[model samples]
Target: MLYVKIHELRKRKFKVAQIAKELKVSRPTVYKYLDMTFDEAKAYTEQPLGKKRKLDPYKDWILAWLEEYPHLSSAQIHDWLLERYPDLVVGGSTVRTYVKDIREVYQIEKKVMIRQYEAVPEQPMGKQLQVDWGETKQKTTDNKEIKLYFIAFVLAHSRQKYMEWQARPFTTRDAIRCHEHAFQFYGGRTEEIVYDQDHLIAVSENAGQLLLTTEFQHYVNEREFNVHLCRKADPESKGMIENVVKYIKGNFADSRVFSDIEDWNSRALQWLQRTGNHQVHQTTKKRPAEVFLLEKQHLQPVSSLLSYESTHNQSITRNVSKDNTIRYKSNRYSVPLGTYQTMSENLVWIEVKDEDQKTLVIRREAKGEVIAEHLVSSEKGKLIQNRHHTRDRSKGVEELKQRLVSCFEDQGQAAAYLDEISQRYPRYRRDQFAIIYKIIQQYPAFIDTVLTKCMAEKLYHANDFRDIAHHLHTLRDEPIEEGQPFYTSSPKHSHIKASTRSLLAYTSILGGRA
Candidate 1:
């Protein structure tokens, strides 16, 4: 307005310098304003009026109708408005413009992102891998409800995924088992595997220093694979595996039914290779399997180092009956019968692997003598005693040595105890010595005690310590004799009833008189 005022004044022959001074605008600007026609001046003042959607009657109806029928199109609104106002004139374009303005107020349309582009070089294939756990519901043949866990591993660049499902809980064992199977499935292991800090593999500092389970460490060390854990709450760290899980859920496992976990997993693997791995990645424009093969080419071969194999070690305990037989798990196995010598203590050692809980056996612990063998029946009526058979008494001691060796096999220094003992006692064939060893087995504390006693007595022979132990047992259980009474039994045959001196001593000593 100030510029226009000055311009109008200038056109009426007012001096430009004077108009500039009055309007507080520059002289050039006043001249520029003066150059404009009446229509231009009107256009400048009318700009706001042209652009603004006025709160007039027709605009009011449009706003009200929009609140009620938000989905109505601009044309629909235009037609509705035309019906109401015969005098009010507007074009489709005007109505469209108003619809856009209303949308901005309501914030309904999808946002447009203007990305500043930067080129990211493709990552080296197999340089990184991703892992995650997925779950699907299943039912057994008998309609038993169950949920199965699948560990998903995917190559980041290729998106080639391997899935392994287990019927059991996602324990540390299951995790390692899955990894081992996945590596075997790929014919090799990747250089680096990214994990989501899954509780089975890694825990937080707050929880304690993140410690991988021994089984998991064994797998990683054996395979020579580097494990990288994603920072907590950072799902994008293993985004490839996460995406694979989503893809599987949507394309394959979603709403799918299976007989059991194994069945579900078999179908999942098939689907992954056929449907998921073969699909073209939206961004990479390459099939996952193609990229995966390229990744495999770049990967270091599965280390020539020992491959991690699944190990299922279980411990079994058995009771030693009066006959020195250790009924472990369910089978009756015997140590040296000398185990029964010690009445107060009883324990036997056995190592078991991959045996059914109900039918596990305890053969003689010694090598040569299958001293006693017992077959365990799954039935309830089976008598453990009926199954026992003694192979040879002469080999019983050797069996005990074998048993002891087997007991300490998993331990370090203890494993060498038998080997060293065997070397020292060459005369005591492992079988003969096993008898004395059975005593040590029955009384493990006696290993040191008998050893010390034997050394102290210079008793190199097993029979010598056996004799000494028997003597100690006898003395320990000896009965007291009541024959000898000692109390000055020169019992006064002479002064039978009335010696004052004797009476006083007796009274003082025994609180009584003769």
Candidate 2:
């Protein structure tokens, strides 16, 4: 404006001094502006509105980045400058201004990304409910940051939401509690509950086969609700609850001062009534709580609340001894052998199998698989055990080996050969010993010959020993005629005939003829 006004005043024949005083400027500034031509003045005005900045050296680089990634923010560009040029000396604000100026000069627009979502078919009322868990950090009233974990539930058709927060991470038991609370709030549950493959719910889902944790599996069975676990990394499958989780974290949890967990949960409930369930959803264009009114009639009535006190706490931890026995009220009850292999501390659960408390049951740590169930004995200091739990003493491998060696004429040689076979097949050494013992008993007469042949041929494998023994036994049992080959010989070559000659003539046909 000053440059154009200087020219305009001069064209009106105003003196340079008068123009300077009228424009409220110094004489040097007015003289500098008066020297510019109209074209030069227009070019000066066209230039980007900023003085030479400290980031002039990186103007081209910044312009290239903005062109390639239009979504890049000023703070991101500032970080890039520090990373690309470690010795860079500039403040964040300076880089921000320079990036802004470059963007405006080049007309490079920073575009916002909009995720495209297809319209999913509306789920049947009371047929589907999406469940998800999320955690966020919120500063409490005392200005201390606390991370709170929460689980969110949303009815698919109505989008009605229910959420609960906890100070610590939620376990399967806690998740069950949250589920009961949600059921009580909604007055019912959906026929099928959709969820991410959360650890609290499922342990793994491979090839569409979902393996629910034991406690969760039992709860699902008890509630009689069909479960549909979503594929990993597929939030769109259960997007309604996912969005509710985000809404709770952003609208309810963000900038909201946390107090005790009870207060936080109370606050969350109030928010659900105020804005969460009450607000008109952007997609449905109807309030969730209002729509749920009609959908609630379709829900299945809550069967029974599996209270925390009723289940999962009746079993007591007991240490499993090396002999696979657990000490109970007064006796040592036996479990199956190898039960101690999986327990880190040899700890297992001993629960009363029946409500009458007449049957005692021992189970695994988490799977609740019953290991043994026995009739409770009233007498003290008695060993209550199952006959099947005993390790068989008659079929011990060492006993078989010792008995087999006693049968052979050269017991020392037999013991040494068996040792070599055991070493060669250590993984199945016991199995090999049993199989060899069976074959030896089958052909007691061929034992000397078979053992001798095996020793000579180094046939230490049980299959090889069996083959040789069977061959010799076959000859003794079913003998062929004298001078007869066991297998028929190939047919003579009668088609290509040669004249018969004496055996001595063969030598004459050789070099002996020379």
Candidate 3:
């Protein structure tokens, strides 16, 4: 009937657009049927719905993947194909269409068991905030892939949101810091902050006893806000934030090309302004920015004295020791090399995080740029050091050892002396070489004599060599110069009451007892 109507309309001199409007059909449809005879239309209607082509090669495996994992998304399937066969040349749309058809043919359905939910009344302004963590993969400019983690916060009343991203998984201190940043973005916080059972914040849910991590617990107490942890596996209780997580991943991050985390988040703010916050919400029928204007008036004021803002953070000062470490709770944590300017009162602030005190964060200033972070030691007086911190010292020790070996005339004696010192005092080799290097610089020729004496007597201690060199230097009244050959000829000083202590005394004394 429609094909005959197109013929009659064309005979009546009806324009394509006009005919399409009158018959409520498309202009292209009118043209297609207008040019077709009865026999041609019959053949067109009887054509096959689908045809085999390029994707037929992968049809079997694609069908198998869908049959095995019904929950796999088209994007995930595309990723898997690329991962399994790196040289597979296929577009995402091509795979999507193929997967859809394969699913229908194999009767593979993605089953979802929906739970019943009660209608939740809209929260009033400043009443509550829902927070959740999300992550996504993005392509860098160089076409390399990187995964980024983020924490998102949404106001329960207005749906105004804030987000922060980092390349690494968040620690407890990091989570608290992001919370403060979100609170500032929203101008203040709600009366209650909602969370899921994130291991970063909560230690355990012991029969309903919420044991929050110690760092976050301190922050909650100091910030004076209530915490609401959603029941495990029940995301519908905080469904608003869960939707926000999906919305962010799908709408913003999926289309973005990431250069770095800072740039990714910086541009996300513009997206929020241009689309996320400005668009009229489906439920509220108002822009989030406009609703937030009214909601900001109800938010609680943030405290500069207590909150961990960019300007101020409540951190305890610890003096930097000569070894470039700070002591906290009987353990020493290292800072970057050269962090210690002087031995006396050079300070860095330290904070212990997690309920078990598992982590330590150290900063150059109170809440300033982080210089070091470490796992807190369980044993007292343990040194928790970052290997990179002592890399320079390692290099310097190598150079010093080379220079000391060159200073000796008998190379065999010099190598043997060094080998014995290193093997005997492995941990203190650097300090030993440091003292020996100084003594060699002061009395060049005299050190050779000490080396020969130490080799014959098998004495490998550096301080003893230093004292013997000084004693010989005083005996000879000649001032030692750089290029002048130094020697001690007093035969009476050949083993003149050189003070010595048993090597076992060093290890026994270090056992923390007399």
Candidate 4:
């Protein structure tokens, strides 16, 4: 307006000094405006009104940083600039101001549009419930940092909410367990549950169609409840539960000391009962607990849905390896040796039950025969073998014992002795049976004597029987006369044999040297 008035006064042939006084402006300003065309004056007025700052030199660099890391804060960028340029010293506030201007100039900063969602007509009590999960990191009383994940459920009408926290991320089984707990907390279930596109439940989405994970699909089928998966990146569809997740992190988890997962969960439950549910909800303007009382009657009875027992019985199929083992949850479990011996597929059914201590029950799907049960391990890459599954060594011992009994059947006492020794020394029964079989093969006549001596000496070892048989053979080799006394020493004989005559003949032949 000043420039237009100055130009018009000049067009009326007013002097620069007079125009300056009339417009209450300086002569230099009036003359400066009067020198410009109308278009140039308008363009000059439309220029950015702020003055240049020291950071004007690094505007491109700041924009580049923002483009690379949009989540970087202004303070972080200021620190980065100090590190990049050793001589550059700038205040954090100055950097922040410059970054704000740069972001506006380039339109690089994320602009969060406040979306207005049309108020959905109120759902009937127990008709719909929204579920979601949120995560945050916190420090415990001991100053140990831990990440916490929480699952929250909110009834659409009454705004009744249920929430539980865990120290680790959730799996499909955990999600299902949370759902079961939420339903039990409400004393019933809703007709349909709304959820975001979480990988634990929603596997994939195509043209607004969702395919649920296998375990979640089975859980929903058993429970007989409809599942509503919100569109991708859209939280407003399940905004109630989303808000509950935030409320839990802000209210229940903030500055909370986590001694342990179980204790923390217990306290979280108490918090929900005392503070979360009892407080007047912001939207409904009624206490959620009070509203839940009226909503409870309309919900599907807990007993009417699938039993909790079946909902938690998650079953999967695993192929048995050549080592008679099956892999489950990164661990290997053994079955009987012949369980998968001849099968073409070598597949077995594994049913996992979520308990205080989780357990895996493996069964032969073909015959519905349970082969093994084991406590599930949290550690990865472990091999858990059942000792009873490898009984082949014991069966071999039994076969050896039967052979030993059949080999010595002719002599009752010998056979009984063999059986006794075999049964007594089961660990070495195969060796004992082999020794007995060898004796029967080599010393068929001395079997009874060897057995008798062995039993009398209380010698049950295989080498003991072999020594006894060898001694008997030595006695048989040197026989003694019955009537004559055995010679105790060398006997002296007066009458010599023909060796004396041979010595005299040799002397005569040596030229009568006698």
Selected candidate, larger lDDT, 3 vs 4: 3
Overall local distance difference test of candidate 2: 0.82
Superposed model 3: Cα runs more than 4 Å off:
1-114, 305-514
Kindly report which residue stretches of model 4 are placed more than 4 angstroms away from their true locations once superposed.
1-116, 304-514
Candidate 1, residues 1-514, lDDT tens digits: the string is 5545775686688897887666555576566557767677567444412355542346557667777766778898888877886666787897887666554333334244454645445667767778899876755566665676678888777777788876544766566666667777776777888888776786443433456644477677777787787778867656667888887777786667668666677788788778888878887899988777667877666643344333342322344677766644334555554555565435343444345453333433312233343445455433465322434544666566666545432333333444554666766657545566566555453344444455544456656656655554555555423332211246557756773565577678987755
Q: How far is candidate 1 from the true structure (C-alpha RMSD, Å)?
A: 28.1
Selected candidate, larger lDDT, 1 vs 2? 2
Clashes of 1: 6
lDDT-sorted candidate list, best first: 2, 3, 4, 1
Name the weakest run of 10 consecutive residues (lDDT summed) in model 2.
479-488
Local distance difference test scores for all models: 0.61, 0.82, 0.80, 0.77
lDDT of 3 by residue, 1-514 (tens): 5667778988999999998777765577678787889887656534311455566766667778888888788888899888988998989898787676555434466655567889899999999999999888889989988889999998989988788888856656678878877877888888998899997789788777889976688888887898889888989899889998998999989868889877888898988889888888777898999999999999999864554442234355677888988887678888998888853447677776786657888988765898899998878889999998875656677787888898888877787888789889988999999899899889886877677666665678998788768876886675544443334355776776877888778769888444
Winner by TM-score: 4
Q: Assess every candidate by TM-score.
A: 0.39, 0.42, 0.43, 0.45
Winner on TM-score (3 vs 4): 4
Query: What is model 2's C-alpha RMSD?
Result: 23.7
lDDT of 3 at 264: 86
